[model samples]
Target: MTARSWPQTAPDSKDWVRDAIEASGDLVYDWDLTADRIEWVGLASGFFGTGDELVPDSGRMLASHIHPEDLPQRLKALTEHFNQHAPYDCEYRLRLQSGEECWVHDRGAVKLGEGGDPERLIGTLRMINARKQHEARLERLASFDDLTGHFNKLRLRDSIDLCLKESYEANVTSAFLVIGVDNLSKVNNAFGYQAGDQVLIAIGQHLDHILRSSDTVGRIGADRFGVLLPRCSDIQMNRAAERILQAVREMSIPVDPARVHVTVSIGGLVFPNPEHMTAEDIVTRAETALRQAKRDGRDRFTLYQASQQQNLLHRRSQTIVTEVERAIAENRLCFAFQPVVDAVTHQPVSYECLIRLKSASGELVPAAAFVPVVEQLGLVRQMDRHVLELAAAELAIHPTVELAVNLSGLTAADPTWFRALKLLLQDRPEMARRLIFEITETTALQDVEETARFIQQLKDLGCRLSLDDFGAGYTSFRHLQALNFDIVKIDGSFIRNLRDNPEHQLFVRNLLGMADAFGLKTVAECVETGEDAGFLANEGVHYLQGYYFGRPSLERPWLAGSQPVATLPALKSGAKKAGAA
Candidate 1:
């Protein structure tokens, strides 16, 4: 037919097709291969909102209304159907003449001539913008966390698995960090779940800003999040975790006029050879380290130790408890004295009595290895009592020497522990003046009223109390004001690398100033170098204790006048570097 002409003799099927297109709200189009013209029929104005005007008849004029980005694809589809007799089935964006845009599902078929060359191409365009939007919503709901808009657990797992597979093939390391919100329950209980949700959202936004673009973060649990750092080493992972911790520490969730601050316990696992590890293995390792961080006291990061197997760890724990029990039963539980000296003068002012378990082989076991296990096994009460009795006996033998003994949180809370100490001092009441009981800052803060009462009872008996690990936990001036502590031991963490760490130096200075304001003596622990000692001495710290003064010894060096300092032993992994230059 010529342009603007319709054959009056057209078949009834044409009317049927037009009726069907209009019923389905579709736009019908036909292109004549020979004339290179396109005709639109059936509610064409409805598709483009261009009134009852004659539609564009030429291919060029029709393509002008199609979206610029979709024009090439639409043309290519038509060409394929016309020249190669291929079906046209594509969905693309359409732009109407009035600046409106919508999605369309375009499908076409070719009609061939007697020579088998394409003569015409016909297609139907159905607006599917609603369906496309629905699909997009479904995709987001499937792939993202509803609360944080981060990846859901399923999507995060897929990303981690992909990274692991690539790293396995390349023999590169990958790391997963699991972050857990501490005190979330308290927030939820005190404020509301809504406030708790706000906290999670804030944490997610903060993490998104802190992580690298390549890293993947997801909400893996209600109070936990997982991050995938592809090809990352342990040190790099730790640095990232440090940033996260610092950010979280600085964040505060505002509930009207009140603000709540929270901290995170981060556990990280590094798979140097990822080939042997699965996604589950990575998460499990990270979770285990996370629990350890929480157990060791929160606001810290712990790395998974692949060298320790589950069964091996269990056995080691069992053996430690058994060893502690045997030492207590056989009366082989002893104390090793490490001198705490005057910071200015190297002379010993007192001794920190470190509990040591004597094995059957006559070798000494350090307290760090067994103390936690002992506390967990409910044996700390007995262990603490035995250590106190031994220290009291030593104090009786050396009437002028002072000894500081460590106390676990459990022991401090146990009524039996206090009674045992009271019984030990029955005949030697004067020994209490030479004794100092050390409780960690975290332990004492667990129950303020109980800790206060305990401190009062000890003071009433003329025994001094020292707060250990002063800056490692939640250090507050309010707690210092409420509790009566004779001395504050600055934790070794801020002191280990003090010479090179300006931050640590500043922290130590502040701690010293705070203690001075409270009129409490400040003792810096883990002083590994003479430079560290001199630094603390200049900062007016009262006492220093570490290998620099003397290693822990079975014999009290102060009891023997002018006794030589004990030789230092090989440093354990993760132990403070003692006696370093």
Candidate 2:
């Protein structure tokens, strides 16, 4: 405390308090009652927006620094303190040297001289403004993912809600989409959890770089991001999703080149449909589309088709669910074998077991139409196992024929499934060699390391694995490196257009060559017509599968001895092409 003269004009206890307040970082001011004037820390001039003004004149400017809202209250508190010698305590706003508003905390003392007249007054003021701002910054950071710094799901939902509000208010179109990184689990397995974080960070940065600032992006789930696009058309949303896909596929994170690849699958919903749906229906609608996308084999985008969504949702109802259950229990789920041909020999290489369900109305529901519903309701594994058993029974009729069945990624990852599959293979030793498990690139890449090990285990049992539609994805090569597949089917698109489109011809060529380079057999799918057969043969494709060869038949008509001609289904390329000639 600053020492005082022997007169002891002020209360001795207030001296230490005044000295302590003055030592604080912010300015402190005091009024010498005996002198009838005010005094404050030199830095007070900066806090009061009077950095160049003389100290005496700065006090008036300090009064002006009090926010207009609190100016009257501040003046009242000050007047009462200085005039009545009342204890002073108040928080007021200050205008800083830069003319920015900040909060100032002030408290002081009024002491009387022995004569009972006010001899001196004291106070302290400090800026607590930055601390308050820091708290707000921390709050904001909490709403985002630390690794990617993308808004977390909480903020994402809010952003979507806000976008919906704006869209409804403005009478404009808007979209909500969920994008998921394909095969992210594989990245986590192959590299490490940190590497997975790196991949997500890269995706977030890339999304930020590619998307407009107005679009909202968030980390909605592990390995998933949600985006809200306001005033967007359906076509525009699709384009934006494609760009995001391309961006991720092309983005090479700063990791080892071999481990850096990533791709995204997107599903979107457009609203309000003014004529049809309401704003609140948007997210559920988007989720419905997302389910379709995942079912369609990841990496592709699906727009909500009401009929399809409703069909699946209807299956969720008790009636359809029971129908599916009854169909399974009654062996009403039928299987047909589509022959995959060895192009050069024009003979069956393997038969893909496609499932069909007999509806209550006796109509046959094709795999393409209802496997989605089956997968959604968690019936795929049951149906898959039933088909295998059915195939086992049918193998009694055609011992030498091979069979390949489609299993969902979800089913394959099931541990019970692996055990069941192992048991099935053990019981059917003769059919084991002929069983080729066909899995899509999406499923195969889900946990590349784990799936690779699983495939190796199958290979050890003398079974073959063929990538179902190899060129249909961005991470095909990544899958190839991760799993040693015996065969890779070039996607049907290239083969479908092989005859007339030269670009497709080139695609077929490159794909076939790549397969050969890997010492793998190639299957050219959807090759119809004699022209397609001729073109694929010319390119030396190892296997050819299409309707032109033979449609999927319950009886394996092509392999039947003296088959009934009427039993075979019509081929897209006509009966002439179905013949060996």
| Candidate of highest lDDT | 1
- Residue-pair clashes per candidate, as listed? 0, 0
lDDT of 1 by residue, 1-581 (tens): 65855556777867876897788899888988778888887888777777767466766766777788988888788778666767789888867767778898989788888998888878788999999998786567456777799886557867877998898789788899999999897997788767888999999999989999999999876688999999899789999999999999999778644789999999998874522455655776788899999999999999977564764665676678788888899998877788899998788889988777778897766766677766654466677788878888899889899999888765665556777888888777679988998988877886554577678888978899999988988767878987889999998889886889999999888888889889999899888899989988988999999878888877678854655444335356346321110
lDDT of each: 0.80, 0.70
| Candidate 1, pairs of clashing residues | none
**Candidate 1 vs. true structure, TM-score:** 0.48
**RMSD to the native, candidate 1?**
28.2
**Listing every candidate in turn, what is its Cα RMSD in Å to the true structure after a full C-alpha superposition?**
28.2, 23.0
TM-score (all chains, Cα) for each model: 0.48, 0.49
